[model samples]
Target: MSDEDSRPVHIRRRGLDPADELLAAGPLTRVATGSGADAGSQWMATTHAVVRQVMGDHRRFSTRRRWDRRDEVGGEGVFRPRELVGNLMDYDPPEHTRLRQKLTPGFTLRKMRRLQPRIEQIVAERLDAMARAGSPADLVEFVADEVPGAVLCELVGVPRDDRAMFMQLCHGHLDASRSQRRRAAAGEAFSRYLLAMIARERKDPGEGLIGAVVAEYGDEATDEELRGFCVQVMLAGDDNISGMIGLGVLALLRHPEQIAAFRGDERTAQRAVDELIRYLTVTYAPTPRIAMEDVTIGDQVIRKGESVLCSLPAANRDPALVPDPDRLDVTREPVPHVAFGHGVHHCLGAALARLELCTVYTALWQRFPTLRLAEPAQENRFRLTTPAYGLTSLPVAW
Candidate 1:
């Protein structure tokens, strides 16, 4: 079959209509571009086709411009906050490679192994807090949101008392409508806070990852760069974890049999995590990229500097790469998924994300074998207007 003809069939499943609107205006449908849902076309069945075409030809569909636009859109440019939390995601080659090299040592398997206990403790504490709150607790607030935010703060050397402010800035920064304004406000506040923290670390460096980054790249990274790095780590790391944890929990709760399987076999947790990542595809929109040069993708030729978005949710669900693509089969043999992105811009915190996910699923199931969604799944509030997809609240009961 021709490449275009071979594209996956995009299905319009039911859930949040707002998300459907966002997906419709996305590159998948060849619709108009802007932030909100109303500025675009109605939901179309061609989204899957668009995703297949983009992923199949990366050369023509460059992520270079997308990475640059990340900074332009509410991240370290003009009205937005500066990139203070720098590890690797935003940089291109050479610079990206250098940053990744320095950061890799801290996220190795051995390091994750060491961090597991703390992760477990954090999970347990959240679960305990949930239990104390009794039945019908908001899982998103208690477990999904709290655990990741706390862990990221700990990793970055931010004290526990300051985590609430960090989360506020993060939430505001991700809101598309408020991004410009909130980013300006939060960026300024965070900059001052980060500068003070960096000065303190300079005087007496702590033993956290932030301290390490400052020690090694202090001269190279300006005060703004350091703050940007902190913001990047916090934003990138916490956003995915929160969404994945919520989705993972919802998936397991939806399929009690799968939860039983997970409980029966510890190995099931890892596979389940993969399935959740693939199924949920939290980073719904592909980070937009601009074409550096003229390129042909399938039947279309995108001119240089034109913007293209690679929708991860649509790509992960593409029937071409995955068998029974729509089905949530935790037992499916490992197939590569782009939930953490692909190629050079792959997520640096993949290891930590996996750790957090695995720990939460395992511990929550083991602790509350009777755990189930306290409210009807339909009643749960999914995120409507943010760059990342997630639930607003996940009420759970045992």
Candidate 2:
């Protein structure tokens, strides 16, 4: 359980909890190299405070990969791959600021609220399908996997008929178990799909988020930015919510008392949703941050050009973050956690994520009051290979 253990942090979870070593690690530790873009060793920020510092101080810890030594050999190396253009996570302050500003209006509280009715409808449709599929259904196939994508389809104005194809690309690209070439292929296809959507929005915009951005930003928003926004939305919105739903439901099944609390009043459900997000911390790390200059954190001095990967799950589980950090207390007073990340690059769709989580958790249980795992939790499959921690299939019965 030494902090210096160089295991890949993303796969460190033992079910819904962060691996003990990750939680036990000091503020910063060295992670083995193969997991990051950097050719040398990468450092991990495990404590809540240190992780916050690494993510928040973009000046010192740059998200742009070229800032790292790995990309430094190439000339002026700021050239982004086709996939990264307008990717807010890959840009620093001014560029990130520009893209984020243009997209901010689409994710504001009011905008997320505007999308709620459609979200609820999508959830209900998935639930109805689950009912038709009958008991012992895989919640992942029946509900978890379908809802987020369908909702996002509605959000991005993906033609209702095309959502299945869109979801396939998302799954293929995110499956880390797949070969790099295959994943890259999926990513290329996904980008092409977004580009087509962006083109359509240019002429006659629709009511979806993509169209709204196109209409509002007009020629000001480049197709690349619009595509980037779509890519980010589908990437973040689909898998994270799907993972949370599957894992969150599994966590609740084991802790039945928490479900009772989660099924309580509106305010209680919202708190439970937030606590689940923190406890599960499904999207493991944000993009690895590279140091632009020497920086001191605790006893460690990260020299310029070293890569730092902040462990979101580890940081959330750090005792410094809350009492009995590993315990899931849905009723605990909301404590700020980095599940949605921190700083200016914090998740743009966080509000939308919360609304979806609250709606899904509350409504699903309402529809199936007796829901329980079809098998023991320990025997269930955890998706260790994906970027997000989730169940490969969550078999449940009412």
TM-score between model 1 and native: 0.81
lDDT for 259 in candidate 1 is: 76
Candidate of highest lDDT? 2
Candidate 2 Cα errors over 4 Å, as ranges = 1-7, 35-39, 67-77
lDDT of 2 by residue, 271-354 (tens): 999999999999889998988888898788998878888999988887888999889999998999999999988998888899
Best by TM-score: 2
Alpha-carbon local distance difference test for all models = 0.67, 0.85
| TM-scores for every candidate against the unseen true structure | 0.81, 0.93
Model 1 residue 14 lDDT?
39
* Alpha-carbon shift of residue 186 in model 2 (angstroms): 3.1
lDDT of 1: 0.67
Looking at model 2, the pairs that clash are none
